[model samples]
Target: MSSKIQVLVQPGTIIIIQNNNYKVRLNMIYGKVRVLRNSHRAFKCIPWLLILFASTSTYAAFTDSLTVGNAKALGLGHAVTADPPGIDSIHFNPAGLTRLKGRQMHIKGVYGLFETNYDLGGYGEYQQGLIDELLEYQYPGSNGVIPPEAEAYFYDEALNSKSSVEGPTVMLPGGMIDIPFAGGVMGGASYSPPGSNMTFATNVYAPMMSGYNRAEDDPGRFFQERGAFTLLTYFSPSVGIEISDELQVGFALNFSYAGMGLELPAREPHLLLWQYGHPWFQDNFCNDDGTPTGTPDLNLCHIVSPYISYGDLRIEADQALVMSYNFGLLWSPEPWITFGLSYNSAVKNDLDGDWEFPIDPFFNQVLLDNMNGSLWPSFQALTGALGLPLPGVAETEAQGKGGKVNVQYELPQHASAGISIQITPKWKYNFDVKWTEWSVFSDIQINFDRDIAFLMLGSIADKLLYRGQNGIEPNGVRYQLNLQDVTYWGMGTEYQYNDKLAFRLGYENRPSAVPSETPNAFIPINDGILYSVGIAYEFESENTLDFSIGYMNSKSHYPPCSADLGNGCNPNNVAYGPYQGQDLRSEVSFLLFEVLYSRYF
Candidate 1:
């Protein structure tokens, strides 16, 4: 649904437009309204009693998925690959810059509100031991073990509840930059010599940006507690040339700064430790006096709880410079129809930063309590006497990283094709289809400056429920992202209400790059739909203003124990294996408002 309102001031004009599949905005800007006795008069008087104020126009969310654009492109649901927006065309379709007659400038600001909500449900039936062990921890018996806070965490609160992401934030080189309303500003300019067949332009913009913070105990934190990722295209120089009467070609070199930081604790509630509770173990293995274990001071039959975490992995990395390129061509066969094709190159980034992975005390206590003294020495001697390939492996200590690190990430390449048709003298239609090569993220590799503790003990843990890396090399870890390539499209229509005003409406279907077999709270998005409305007014022959507002939403649901099916809950996942038996329902939504002003001289 779409509606437009206009309020005339003594010296200037004010207008408001509405509609998105989600989110709501009112009728008018500041003005006066009179009591109306008729429907016509009622709508006409809306401005008298209301006021609406919106600011600069631009778009930036998610990272490098082409979710960023100016007001005009967004208004048309980014179907403008064929009819790019003024100076900003340096990014969308550089060939379009050749259409500008003289020196022109475009300024845009964006107000972006992004929110994610998740519902967590109980674990599966196979995970009963997890509850029993936690119960013992909450209320110890003969053994005077310290009572942990697991009671409230599992039963009273936290689990099987709802949680949401906190307010948004953006990270740049200078550090955190926050605006009044989770917004950002960007601009561009272009110039062409008199009667020349070429144009040059530059712009500053974010290809995609998103970040979130959650309460330490928030259920959603099970996946990741806090993180931020952004790619800012601070410099892009472009050139467009009119090759012939009907063809235009262009190219642009984009240089950007990207930062990615994350912190998450790892938890694994596998079924490996439940064998100690079996009746057979106690009935047959215990001596008449009770307590008969093989190794001195070691209790191999002691029950081990699976509710706790190994420790937290905190990483903060940034790439100072990332480079990519964009090239596009525009063709006009008839006066009323135009065709466009564009390609964006992929960029690989090697980031350097600091990382720390501290092992939980519980991980150390298990080894310390049973093998406290010469028992550890005897185990080391036994392994050495056996001529084991991993000499004295049982004597090796657990480890973690707390130093410099390097990681590899790639921004996928994508291509788009668009068509624009002039239906009637006052109507126009545009459609575009795009493809993104997201499969480049199948595996993410991280290298620590030195051998981390976890890798040293990786072999033993891999024998349990985890699948180890093919080759456990020193100072390295690998996680499988397994993202899928995707294709999506959008359509838009415009009505020219005389030469001074135009109305535009658009819709786009965006699908997730993450596959269903590997979804978790971290990548909550599935498939999404975007709804948009806007008004383009040429207040003067040489100046134009574009206002656009949009809403986007995506939802996903995962059943308990999905991991049992082809390792759905892969341990190599950045989120770890905590999601194995928990049901999750997630929704991610965005509300956007933008204002773009372009002036020509």
Candidate 2:
């Protein structure tokens, strides 16, 4: 009997035990698990090993929909409902699989380029001038200008500082393939199986790849920075069956994985000082002591505020996985006309992962500091005199914790219909209408497995009526996107010049799901008009190459407003207060290119 065991560790770390008794223990960090053992029961630990490996895989950011697709469909702005004839049909209208006559294979790849610009000077003008003035006046000596030390303290003490304020370019890749077994026809004494003329297919596509990195000093940092990736890729396996010569149907199962991360300001600086009874801020004309004074000090009254300094609370979920499905049908009642419909089910995901956040060293040591080394000692002596322990002040340390954080997100369900008409022997036209149920994405909630370090900040607000000014109760940390349902319209034309050459062109109007009043810096998406063109060339028998490109441009602006949460833009009603009343404008565009090779044998 052989008793040698092999163990693989992450980061290329490995352990091998020839004949030693070892017990294994596993610990989790950054969504990865590490196994430590000292018992030789390797056979019994195999299942545990599998679980550990599975738990280590993590995913991030995902949205309601993807904008890129296969070259042919994308060339038609994805309006292939009634003209589906290849692997792309698996997603558009799988029933079109019956259009294939022989052995079929297709390999496709797509690349996407994205750009976003935000005119956030309105938000920055307030915070930047405040900070500069604070440094020059209170901590002076830079000749009436912001000192280099002040600038360095705000920008140099964080992650992704350089790109935190701007959106970055993103790349997306996608492909699909189908295999069919030419089973005989059904009925008429043949009595063939249900799917005798069926085809099987698989696809991998990145439908949503969008995010940004905002500079730490960006006034919007209190709202969001190091923006969440919201990136999602779908793996689908499907089957298409011809119910009859004139009608066909298909079904597909979709498995989606997402990688997500987000960072935002967690506490108010002014509130922190007030809660700790700091001397720099006098409350109700009283000094650090509770005694009321007739002459209230005004010199240092305006120095401390939520906008003075910054602290970050970041959340990350990797390899978050979920499942959904799609069904499609196509029918041709006449020789020159075809109709198609497809429905994609909603996907619900509960992201389980870890979170890391350290108190801001700059905020703690500078803005909230009492400006005296003995302040803590003095508070401790006073509390001890009253027979009570001193209250805890904000301590600076990275609170890295490993546990399941539930991020409940749902991809909206969609339904679309399309018609294709053969106007001439060489010319064909197509049109489509689609609807998305985006109301499911009304808001996003982040639930931690254990009490987060910043919960106390919100709890203090509720206890001290700090949130009363905003006219809301503390619900902890969350975001209110308040999105709306959207509809899309598309049109395309294809010209079959000859058996060896073909041309295609298309246009589509896709509206934004989020309202302008609730604009978000994380996703710079807007109502876009897509223009596309493509060509196909057949150089050999039943073999062809298809290439195409599409471009979309859109813009969105959020002016200052006052209204209820569900009706209009109201930042005070949301968790991140710093973004309130700040005018935000964005210009966004997307360019997609694809190439596909298909062969029939």
TM-score to true structure, per model? 0.77, 0.66
Query: What is the lDDT, from 0 to 100, of the residue 487 in candidate 1?
Result: 88
Q: Write the per-residue lDDT of candidate 2 for residues 1-601, one digit (tens) a residue.
A: 2222222222211112111333222110101000000011111111111111111101121222233346788677677888884765656776766666444455555555655455543433433443455555546575546456544433322221222235432211111101121000100000112335876555444444444444556643443444333333334567788888789898877665655555545433222222233333345555455433554322233323343433445556644357778789989899899999988787676665655554456544442333233465576476457443333342223233334566666667888899999999899999999888776754445566554333423333333333323211112233334567778888899999998999999888877665555444434445678889999889868777888888877665555332121011222233232333345555656676777777653
- Candidate 1 local distance difference test against the native: 0.60
Task: For each candidate in turn, give its C-alpha RMSD to the true structure in angstroms.
Answer: 14.5, 13.8
lDDT of 1 by residue, 418-453 (tens): 999999999999999998887775445667776543
Q: Give the clash count for each candidate.
A: 12, 30
Candidate 2 overall lDDT versus native: 0.49
Number of the predicted model whose TM-score against the real structure is largest: 1
Candidate 1, 70: how far from true, in Å? 1.1
- lDDT values of the candidates? 0.60, 0.49
Query: In model 1, how large is the Cα lDDT of residue 422?
Result: 94
Which ten-residue region of model 1 has the weakest summed lDDT?
A: 32-41
Cand. 2 TM to true fold: 0.66
